[model samples]
Target: MSSIYIHIPFCKQACHYCDFHFSTSMGKKDAMIQALIRELELRKDEFRDEVVDCIYFGGGTPSVLETEEITLLIQTVYTHYQVTTDPEITLEANPDDLSEAKIEALHASPINRLSIGVQSFFEEDLKLMNRAHNATEALQCIMLSRKRFQNISIDLIYGIPEMSTARWIQNIEQALALDVPHISAYALTVEPKTALEKFIKKGIIPPVEDEVAQAHHAILVERLEAEGYHNYEFSNFGKPGAFSQNNTAYWEGKSYIGIGPGAHSYDGKRRAWNVSNNPRYIKAISQDMLPQDVEELTLTDQYNEYVMTRLRTQKGVSLSEVQTLFGDKMHRYLLQQAQSHIEAHFLFQEADRLYVTKKGKFLSDGIAADLFMLNLFQHPFDQNSNQS
Candidate 1:
C-alpha cells in the first residue's frame, strides 16, 4: 500500500540536537499550507491507481498547526486522491503544544495516531536538549492524550551527557508507566553544525560516548521485551498491532508521495526530494511546479538499500529473495561477506533468513555497510548496465 508524508517545516523553537529542515518563523505558515495542497493536487496522478493506507503529518512539529489546518490538509488528500476507508493518519507532536483544548481538538480530527516528542522526562535533560516542554508538561500531555487516543507513540532520548544508567532506566520506566503502545527511542547524536556539537566541542557539554549508548540500548531491549514490547526495529518498540503503518510501509519499500518542502518520495525504482528551502518550495508550487530532484536507483543501489533497511528490522534479509532479485552472484557475495560477522556471533542465520544478533543491534548500520557492494565490478546478469 502507498502512503503520503506531509512535512510541516515550522517549529515553536529549535532543539539543540536537531538538524532537520525547519524554521522557527510562522510568517509563511499559511502560504506553506496552501503550497502543500497545491503540490498534492499536482502529484495526484502519481498515485491515481494506488490506495493511500497511511497519511503521516511529520515535521518540526505538526501539533503547532491549527486543528482546522490539519483537517483541511487531510480533506485535500481525500479530494485529490483515493484513500483507504480506515487509513492510519498520524500527527507528530510536541508535548508543549498539546494542551487540553488542543488534544480535544486533535481527537475530533481525522488524526488517529499521535507521535509525541517527549525526548526526556527529566528537567536537566529537557534543558540540555532545549525541548519546549518541561518535565511536568511532558508527563501531563501523555496522560491527556491517552484519554482520547489509543494509538499513541512517545519519543525518548538516551545517552545524554552526564545522564547516568539509573536516570536512563528511570526514563524508560516513566515511558512504560505511561503505557503507550509505541516508543521510538534514539541516542542523542551530535550532528555537525548543530548546537549539540558546538557545545560538546567547546566543552560546554561532555561528549556523548558510544559505550554509554550501547549500554542504554541493551537495557532498553531487555526491559521492553520483558514488558511485551517487540523491538521490531532498531529504534522502534511496539506492542502487538501497534507498529507504525506509515513507517512500516517505508521500511518495506512501498511507494509513497511526500508533500511539502524538505520532504522525500520513493517509487521503488526512483527517489525524489523537495527543496529544503521553504520559500523556494512555495514559489515553485504556486506556479504549478514541483521543486524537487529525482534519481533512478541502479541495481547495486537497490541491493544496498534492501540490505540496510531489511537488516535493521527483525525480519532480517531473505537469502532466497536476494538470489531471486539480485541474482546468484550478489547473493553469494552477501553470504561471503556475512560469514565473518556470522562467525563472530554478531549475526546469525536461521533457515534462509539472516538476522543481526543482539550483540550487533546497536552497530547494525556498520554491519550492513560491510555487506554493501561498492560498484567496483559488473556482473553479466546486472540489469543497469549503463552504470557499469
Candidate 2:
C-alpha cells in the first residue's frame, strides 16, 4: 500500500519556534487548493502500481481550511488515484480552528483521524511558543475531539525554556486524560532563523538545555509506556493498532505522492519536491507546468537513510535485509561501524538484527550517525517537505 501527503502551507499566525514554509496571510488559500488538485491529477501515476491506504492532510495548520475544502481535496484524490477500501485519512489541525461546529463538520467528512497540534496545555507554554491557541482552546479541542474521533493524535513539545518538570508532567497527564491513542512528542530545538533562535541570540529567552531535554524525554517515555502506549518511534507513541500509517509508511520508505506548495514525492530511487512558494506553485500548475525539482538517490544515500530511519523504530536495523538490499560489503561496513557502539552497550545485535538499547535510544541520532558509511553525508530535508 502507498500513502499521500497533502501540505496546506498556511497558518493564522507563526509559532516562534517554527521554521516551516508557510504564509500568515491566507489570501491565496482557494487557488492553492485548486493547484493541489491539479498536481494530484498530473501525478496520478505516482503510486500507480499500489493502492493508497493513507492520506495525511499536514500543514502550517490544515484546520485553517474549511471542511468543504478538505473534502474537495479528498474527492480529488479518490477521483484520480486508486485508494484502499478503508483509507486512513488524517488532518493536522490546530486547537483554535477545531471549534464544536468545526469538529462536527470534520466528523462528517472522510477524515478518519485527527492529528491536533496541542503543543502544551499550559497558558505560559502557549504564550511562550507564540501559539495561536490558548490553554483553554487546547484543552477544549482535545476534549471535544475525544467524543467524535477515536483515532486522535496530539503534538507536544518538551524542553522549552522555563518549562518546569512539574509542568511537563502535567502536560503528559493532560494528554493521557484526554484519551488520545497517539502522541507525537518532540524536544523543542531552536531551528535556525526561527523567531526562537533570534530570541535566544538577543537574550530575550533562555536557550534549551540538553540535560533538561533528556530528563523530560525520560518522563515522556516512561509515563507513556506505563499507560500502554508503545514508543514505536523515537518521537512517537501509540496504543495498540493506533500507529500512524502515513508516518510508518514514510519510515519504511514506501512510495508516496505529496501535493501542494513545498510537498515532496518519492519512488524507490528518485525524490522530487514542488516549489515552496505558493504563487510560483499556483502559477505553474495553472499553466499545466510542473514546479518541482528531482533527485536520484545513490546506493549510499539509500543505506544512510535506512540506518537513520530504522534506528529510530523499535525493530532497529536488520542485517539480513541489509544483506539482501544493500549487499554484504555495505552490511559488513555497517557492522564494523556499529561495533564500538555495541561494545559500549548502546546497541544490541541478535541473530541478524541490530537494535538500540534503552540507554542508547535517547542518543539514537548520534548512534545512527556513527553507523554511516564513508562519504554518505545527506542533505537535511527541505523544510516544507516535512509532514502533512
Q: Which candidate is the best by lDDT?
A: 1
**lDDT tens per residue, model 1, 230-313:** 999999999999999987888778899999999999988999999999999999999999999999998888888899999999
Local distance difference test, per candidate?
0.94, 0.90
lDDT score for residue 311 of model 1? 92
TM-score of each model, paired residue for residue: 0.98, 0.96
- For model 1, the superposed segments whose C-alpha errors exceed 4 Å read 376-381, 384-388
What is the RMSD of candidate 1? 1.8
Q: Report the C-alpha displacement of residue 88, candidate 1, in angstroms.
A: 0.7
TM-score: model 1 vs. ground truth: 0.98
Error of 1 at 7 (Å): 0.4
